[model samples]
Target: MHHVTQIKEFKVIDTCRDAVVINTNIDDYKAHAHFADIRGALECISLINRGLLPKSRYYKTACKRLLTPEQYEGLVERTKEKYININKGVRR
Candidate 1:
């Protein structure tokens, strides 16, 4: 049997009723990139929320690099929480 990959599509509607469709194949590399992007965005938010964004450059870099480790798993959990909330139509 041959393996087949399914492409998933996401649909979103704006306030003005404009609809947008995004096609995501989610290959391994793309999936890794998406995870990294989400982590990086969450790390930025964490730094800003903790008032560390304007701190030492070294600290900011280190935070972004280490914030997704097993010890810092809360960051990923927070990201998922925000994702769910947004999907539930809870606007920030």
Candidate 2:
């Protein structure tokens, strides 16, 4: 698989087109602990900061960051059983 270099990353992802257009007041993945948890290194941030992790890692990071250690092992399992509902899809 190919990955982008940081110096050239900006060129690949343009903000004018990728910005979130959802309601600011609503709590989506950004507000949920899941986001921070999934984004391994970004676990320290509590509030929102733009362009934290690469777009590719968003949903995996969300699943990791928000869930507890115990939950991580079970989340996907629960999802398979239709017990967990995650909005892993990107917001339009």
- Which predicted model would earn the best TM-score? 2
Which pairs in model 2 have colliding backbones? 33-66, 34-66, 37-64, 37-65, 38-61, 38-64, 38-65
In candidate 1, position 43 carries an lDDT of 41
| Candidate 1 C-alpha error for residue 75, in Å | 20
As a whole number from 0 to 100, the lDDT of residue 40 in candidate 2 is 34
CA-lDDT, candidates in order: 0.33, 0.32
Mind giving the per-residue lDDT tens digits that candidate 1 earns over 38-80? Answer: 3343444445345444244543444344333432333322222
- Cα miss at 3, model 2 (Å)? 35
Q: What alpha-carbon RMSD in Å does predicted model 1 have with respect to the real structure?
A: 17.9
Candidate 2 lDDT over 4-79, as tens digits, reads: 2122111111132232222223344442322222233232121122322223456445434434445445532211
Off by over 4 Å in 1: 1-36, 54-92
Stretches of model 2 off by over 4 angstroms after superposition: 1-56, 77-92
Instruction: Please give the range of 10 consecutive residues that has the lowest summed lDDT in model 1.
Output: 10-19
